[model samples]
Target: MDKAMQKVNERLTPEGKMDVLSKWEVHTLLTASKERFSYEFRACSLAVLNTGSTEDNAKAVLEQYPDFKIEVIQQERGIKLQVSNAPAQAFVDGEMITGIKEHLFSVLRDIVFVGNEIETNPRFDLEKTEDITNAIFHILRNAKALQTEVLPNIAVCWGGHSINRIEYEYTKEVGYQLGLRYLNVCTGCGPGAMKGPMKGANIAHAKQRITDGRYIGITEPGIIAAESPNPIVNELIILPDIEKRLEAFVRMGHGVIVFPGGPGTAEEILYLLGILLHPKNKEVPFPMILTGPKSSEDYFKQIHHFIESTLGFEAQQKYKIIIDDPALVAREMRSMIEDVSDYRRSTSDAYYYNWILHIDKEFQLPFIPSHENMSQLELHKDQETHLLAANLRRAFSGIVAGNVKEEGILSIEENGKFQISGDEEIMTPLDKLLSAFVEQKRMKLPGSEYIPCYEIVKPRNLS
Candidate 1:
């Protein structure tokens, strides 16, 4: 079979996890793969099957394999996937790669479970913040992400998938140091920074003869096609939405290390900052460090300036900044994590999840990145700093959607750039920071020119 034109057909059985499903679960999955929910399920399945892709364009990937089809067939023994026209790259000697097969079943498991148990069930009142948090907890618990007896050793790394070589290498160095200390890694589970950390940690774990090091990758539907799970992700999870994905990262990880990135990274930074700055979370011992290689010194400077100018110095004090030193970054985070563990033990909070953290409804509710919402964002200093951070985070989230998500890309193509207007005080610094990202070529995958999907404007009242 020609690698380009020849498509392989196969029946894949779950080899690792999620092998068994109830009759109802299997029926729901079968329905989801049909016409009603076909697009969502197919898109996610395609992403899982097309792992190792370097291209970040979701639309292009789908178009490239227009004939690809996946069906959930109920068998006498169990459920099996009937996949036709899948990417030839996913196969080795005509057999689907073992890891990709596992991921495909995991996607089926999550989509069916979430659709039936969370979306359609009346018990989960997503309107209530606590209920929403409970739903997230249940999802993670169902995935077996929360291990109560385990110490707090997971470090969530956030950065741009379109990072430079230097920045990517720095992320690996930090991950190596973290692994040397027996810390596991959790990332958004895509390329560049996300892949680098896991790659580095795997080697460190091997060196230490640690067989069970976890490389957890948490993502969502909207962004999954573009940022498909990197092969290094041993534990893959698909959250219902980006908001839940962000929450899962904070809840599941012991600490966070942010590297130089674009708007997505900025959005993650703001999300955590908003949560940490909440009055109720004042005493929480969450460790957050922003670090990068020497070339990224100015990068962190711009980020620091932006945060300070917008959220004030109090938010600035919430996280530490270390430049050009990966070893120290890991050591400092490890030490701070000790404090986190002690706090959790003292407060009777589980080491696996940060149950005591107060996440307001504002942070929990999903923010639709529509043009009107972007235009009406309250990016002024009138509200509490945390509230302001939430809005700012939404602003960046819109940019992220416009940059990579398929819906946002189509919206931009049809409606033109999203209009984002706010107080000049905020807009000025925000614009500067965004401009720096584009100028640094951090907006899109390397060699692909970035077209601005959002136009920053002055507030109407001020104008």
Candidate 2:
């Protein structure tokens, strides 16, 4: 270890959100050295320590601080963190940065809570759809994410963490428009498109004197290391996985605005479309807008073409695409939110959570994204649109895992590349869409060459 790397032992109190831990939980956390929690805690802690860093490579970040270690220390009053060879960026003049300290404990709080209460507790039946939603609600409630007093103003922004300057600026402009209308922001809690909205919203909120603006970030364990929660996120909630994280965004926000992004953004769009396509959810009003700068017009065109070719007209109708018009995008979203408000009010649904939306069990279940699982997905168009969307969602989920996730990366290294075989009609457009993403440099950050983590194979036709 370097001389500057110092071992710091201190007892810290939880900041705004988390405060106390049960004795059993404290003991479990304190003794989480050889288990998954230790690995998760260390990776998440390192990511928090590496806040404000521009680099997005998780492996590189880990390599930089190979010796940095964090351990849980149990105490009579909750617990404390014992950090060894800790990053100096997280500390100043012998004291840890207050925000970073709070984030560290927040990680501990969520991990323990999820592992013990949600996963192990028989009360939350993970197999059932309602049970899964309940589990998500409990996790968010534990994080104090949902507010009863707040109106329907949270705009969930979805886009690539690795975006160009033009796209990033465009996201900011849209965010500024949203902020001008007193709307708050939520994102995947990463950089690039995610950070851009919050950054722009912050300035606009200040100008409008909106002091209580919420910049919420929702993330899961697998991708947190690669895309560390951006510094602008005042409220952070860690879902158990990507599926729950996506669900949380839709349930909590009144509207969604998608900017130019890669497979992950595509997955989000499909997920939302799948829900909207369900017969029960068709009447439930939820606003979705896809917008970008003029430069990104081609990107949206490709995405639109892909959706039309795959999910058909119904999926395409769920969202409106606006090019280079931030004000109009915000105005449209605001107007649609009013409809959402009126509909929810008439239906007696809670303003904080959209209880009316019907999310199918297929979408709720956690996808393992293994080689066998990826190959076995039902990608034919003969089924219901919503069911097809669920399968398509899983396909993208696998691709997402193969791209940046540690397990997926290792799988690719060992097993070559994941192969996706489906109907020729679907495979053709899917290949073209994925090819466009690769061509436009949306698959990974600029300057990093992307070796495809998936192969799209066409199905055999017996004519």
Taking every candidate in turn, the Cα RMSD to the unseen true structure, in Å, is 1.4, 2.2
Candidate 2 per-residue C-alpha lDDT over 1-463 given as tens digits, one digit per residue, 9 for 90 to 100: 5534544545565655444667876666666533757777788778887777666666667777888877766667776677777677667787888867767777877776465567668999889999888888888888788889766889999999879999999999999999998889999988889999999899999999989889998988888877888878888788888889999999999999999999999999999999999999978899999999999999999999989998999889999999999999989988888888888889989888887899999889899999999999888888999999999989999998998888888888899889998888788888898898898888887788889999986674523
- Give the local distance difference test score of model 2: 0.85
- Choose the strongest candidate by TM-score: 1
Give candidate 1 misplaced runs (Cα > 4 Å).
Answer: 1-6, 459-463
TM-score of each: 0.97, 0.95
Number of the top-ranking candidate, with lDDT as the measure: 1
Point out the worst 10-residue segment of candidate 2 by lDDT.
Answer: 2-11
With a 3 Å backbone cut-off (N, CA, C), the pairs that clash in candidate 1 are none
lDDT score at residue 90, model 2, on the 0-100 scale: 68
Could you give candidate 1's per-residue lDDT for residues 150-193 as a string of tens digits? 88999999999999998898899899999999999999999999
